[model samples]
Target: MAKFSVVVVFLLLSPFIDGLRFLVVGGTGRVGGSAGAYLCRLSRAEGYDPSDVTLILGGRSSSSYEASKARISSKLIALGLAVPSIEFLMVDLDTPIVPLTATIESCSPTILIHTAGPFQQRTDPNLLKSAIALNIPYVDVCDEPSLCSKSKALSSTVPAIVGAGIWPGTSAIMATEAVHHLRKFENSGDISFPCDDETIDLSFYTAGTGNAGATIVSATFLLLCQKALTFSNGKKAEIEPWIGSRSVDFGGDVQTKTVRLLDNPDVFTLQSSLSSPNISSRFATSPELWNLLFGAMKTSIPKFILEDKNLMQRLAVFSLPVIRFVDSFVGATNAMRVDVSSKSGNSVTFRVIHDDLEECVGLATASFAYEVLKGMDAGIYYPSDLGEEERKGILERVKKEAVLWDFETSYDK
Candidate 1:
C-alpha cells in the first residue's frame, strides 16, 4: 500500500516537474549557449520530463535566435539527448523598459538565468526588477563588483544569486570551504578569531577563453580602467589594476602562468561571507605577448580614453580581429587557484583547470541552476554562502567537465 501511495504521488508531481522552463538572456553567445545546452542535458539527467521543461534561447532577432537554437541543438545531439522543447524568446535588454519587461514576463520561465554581460558600468536593474515582480528566482553570471552590489540590494523582493559563474562563483565556494575546514580542524593554536587572522588569495588565468565578443572586450577594457579591490589586514584596500602581478602554478599539465590583479565580484562579496580577515584576487590572460601589449597600453593610453566607456568600447570593437587571432596561440584554457589560511596554523588550497572555457562556464552556471531549481525562500545569496550540500553538488558537477580539478590541505604541526 505504501509503495502504491508513493507511485501515485510521483505521478501527480510529474507534470509540475515537467513544466520547468529555463530562459537564457544571452543565449546566442558562448556563455549563454554553453549554459543553455548544459541546463537541458542536466534537466533530462535529473529525470525531469524533457517535453515539459522548455529551453528558451533569447535573442534580439529571429535569425540570431535560430542560430542559437541550431548550435545548442547540435550540442544536445552530440551528448546523446534529444533536444528538449526548445524555443526562442525575443528579448533585447537594450529595449525600452516596459517592452523589455513585457517580453521577459511573456517567457514565464521558472527561473531566469541572466548571462548578458559586460555587466560593468550599468545602473539599470530592469530585468531583475521584472524578475522580482514576476516572483521567479533569478541567477546571474555577473563579474562586475559594483553591479553585483546593486543587484544584491534587491534580495528582499526576489530570490537571486549573483556572480554565479566560474571565478566569482566557484572560486568563492572554494574559499568558503577552505575557511570552513580551518575553523573546524585548526585548534592547536590559541587563535580562535577566524575573522581576524585568516587570509584568502584567489588567482585566475584564461587563454582567450569565452567568445571574446564585444562585451568581453569591453569588460576587459573597463576592468583595466578601474582600480582592483582587496580585503587585507582586516580592512579594505584598493590597488592599481593589473599592477600586482604574480606567477601562479595551475598544476596538472597547465604548469605555471602569470596573473595580475583585477576587480571581481568576489573581492567584495567574500568580505562578508567568509571569516577571513584578508582576501586578494587577481586575473591574467594567456600568450605572453598579449600581456606585454596590455602592459604597454597601461602607460601609453591616455587616462581619459581608458576611463571613457564609449571610447574604450569603440577600441574594443575595432580590436576584435586581432584579439581573435591572438586567441589561436593562447588555446582557450581557463584556470583558478585559491589559497586559504588561518593564523591557527592550518591552510587549504584548491585548483580548477579547464581547457574549454565556454563549456566549463556552462557547467558552472548549470551547477548553480541546479541549485536554483531547488526552491529557496526569497533572498539574495553569494556563491560562497551556499550550504554545504549545494557546494558539494556544484563541485561534483564541475569535476565531470574539468580537465584538472584538485583540492589539498595542510596543518601547522
Candidate 2:
C-alpha cells in the first residue's frame, strides 16, 4: 500500500467515540481549522464516534462557511475518513460578553478552543472570562505575555490553559522533558555527563507560517515592536527584539537557519515555572527577507510608531502584501529545537520538524486540548507544568505528526 493508503487504513482502524462537542473560535482560519481537523482525527483515534464528536466552527461571519466546509470535506475524503458532525457559528469577540455568553450558552460545547487572536495589544480576557463563567474548559494559542499573566490570574477561579500553541505549547513540553532527561545523566557511569545546574534554550524556524490571516501578521508586528523577555543569569531581562542570533541546523543539513530573539512568552513562563534559571526562545522564518525587513524596521522606524498599538497593527496589515508573496515561494516547513543543559555539564537536545506550520500548530494545540478534555487538574497551566506521565502522553501524540530528534552532541554549540 502507498503511504497515503496506510494513513487511511490507520484512520479506519482507529477507535471510535461518541458525544463530544468542540467550539473552535476562528474555525474558518488557519490555526483553528487545523486544530479542528486534528482534534477530530485524534478523537477518532481514541475511539470517539465521528457522528458524536461535533465541531462548531465559530467565525465572525457565516459567509465563509461553505468554503470552509468544502475544504474540510476534501481533506476528509482524501484521508478516507467519514465526515464528522460540524456546525457553523457566527461569533464576534468585539461584542459584550453577554451576547457572546448567550451564543456560547446556546451552543453548549464541551470545551471552547480560543484561537482567534492578534493577542499582542489585547489585555482584556473577556473571552476567557466567559469560559470561566460558563464553567467550561478553555484553551488558547495565546502568545502575548501580558495576556497570559492576566489570564493566569484567574486560575484560582477557572480552568484555563494559556499559550497552548506550537512554540509555547509543545516547545515548552520538549524543554521540560529535556531537563528531565539531562538530570538522569547524574546516575550515568560517565562523569562527563554530570548533571547539576541547567539552561534551557529554544530555537524555532517557520516558513511564513500561521495561515490564520492578518491576525498572525499583526501578532508578529506586535512582538517585533516590543522587547524580548528572556531569563538568564537568574534574572528576567528585556532585550531588543530580533537582536540575539544563532544558526541552527535542522537535521541532516536540510537547512541551517538563522534564528533571532523574539518576544516569546515561553522564555519567561518556563523560567518562573521551571527550575532552569536560564531560559531563552528565539525564532526565524524562511525567506530571510522578512527577518531583514523586521530588523530594519526595529532600527529605522520611529519609536512612536512602534509604541502605538494601532499603528503597529496597521503596519502589519500593510506589510501583508509582501509577506504573502514571499510566503508563496518559501513553502511551509516549521521546525523547532530545544536544548537543556545542566550546570554539571550534561545536556540533552530535542528537535521536531513539520511539513506544514498550520498543521503542526493545529495538532500541537489539539494535543493539549486532548489532555485538557481527558481531565487535567485545571487552573491556569502551561505545558511546562505538566507531570512526566501527562507530558509523555501528549508527546506520544505529537510525535506521530512531527519529526522527533532526541540525541547527544558535543557540548559546544
Candidate 3:
C-alpha cells in the first residue's frame, strides 16, 4: 500500500515533468529560425531531453494550408529533430487577430516567443490586440521602441515582456544591473542600499545586426513620411535617421566602429524605461559588411535596393555563397558595453562577448523566454514584476552564457 501510494503520487505530478511547447510565431525568420534550431540544442546541452519540445512554425497559408505541413515537417526531420507540425495559418498585418488567439489557445502553449514583427514599422490595432489577447505569458523580440514603450502600458492586460531580444531586452537588464551595482551608498553603504542615483551616463552598442530587410527599409519610409521622434536627455526630440549618423568605437577588433541611429524599438524602450539623465544608443557593424550598411543608406542611388521587398530573400540566397567565399577571413562577433557612473566616484561596467551575434540575439531572447515561462503564473505579466531573486538568476544566467566581465572602482569624493 505504501509503495502503491508513492507511485500514485508520482503519477499525479507527471504533468509537471513535461517539457514546454514554445510556440514561435515567426519561427521561420532569422531570429526565430536560429532560435528553433538552437533551442533544442540548448535544451539538450542543459540535460533536457530535446525530444520533449514541440516547435510549430507558421507561415502564410499556401495554395492549400495543409500541403505546406509535409514540407515543413521534412525540414525539421532534416535538422534531426522531431517532426514539428507546420500549421498553415495565414499571418500578416491584415490577417484576422482572433485566429492568433485561437491558434495560441489550441496549442495551449506554456509560453509564446514572438519574433514576427514590424509593429512599429506598421502599426496594426488588431494584430497588437491579438498578441495582447493571448494573455498567457507573451514575449517579443521586436526592435521597435514605439511597440516596446506601448507594450509597457499593456502590462496590466497581459504579462507582456517586450524587447526579449538583445538591445532593450538584455541591455535593459544590464542597464538596470549597471545602475544598481555601480553606485554604493555613503553612510547607507553600512545598511547596503542596492542603488541610489543622483547622476547617470550610458551607451548601448550592438555590432551584430539591426532592423534588417524590409523592417529597416519600411521604417525609413516612415521617417520620410513622418517626423522621427528624437530622444535626448529623457525627452522626446526630433531627428532624421541616416542623417543623424555618428562614428564611435564600439570598442576594438570590432574597433573604432561607426554607428548610426537605426530605427529600433530599443531607442524608445530605454527612453521611457530608465531614469538616466544622459544616454545614447550606438548601432554598429563590422567594416567588411559595408555593403549591407551601404544598402542601408536610404538616400543614395543604392537605395533602390531598399525599396525591394525581396531584399531579405535575396540576402538568404546570397548569404551562404558570400560567407563560404570569404570563409577564410569572414569573422563575426557581438559585443555590448555599458558604462555607468554616479556623482560621487563610483562606476560599473559589463562587456559581453559572442562569436556569432545574429544567433546570439535569439539565444539571449530564448533564454529569457525560457525563464519567463518558468516563472510565470496564470494571467497577464511582464519583466517588471520579477523580484530581486528572479532578476539575479536571469542576470547570472545571461552573464554565464554571455561570457561577460565585471569591473568596478571607487574613490573619495
lDDT against the true structure, each candidate:
0.78, 0.77, 0.53
Give me the overall lDDT of model 1: 0.78
Compute each candidate's TM-score over C-alphas.
0.90, 0.88, 0.72
Clashing pairs in 1: none
Q: Tell me the tens digit of each residue's lDDT in model 3 across 354-382.
A: 55655566677666766654434332323
Each candidate's root-mean-square deviation in Å?
4.1, 7.0, 6.8
Q: For candidate 3, what is the total of clashing residue pairs? A: 7
Residues 143-258, model 1: lDDT tens digits: 87877778777754445788998877988887777777776776433323473378888998888744536667777777877878888787888888888888889887768888
Clashes of each: 0, 9, 7
* Candidate 3 TM-score to native: 0.72
Regions of model 1 farther than 4 Å from truth:
1-18, 187-196, 210-212
Question: Which candidate ranks first by TM-score, i.e. highest?
Answer: 1
Clash number for candidate 2: 9
lDDT per residue as tens, model 2, 165-192: 8887888888777766665555453322
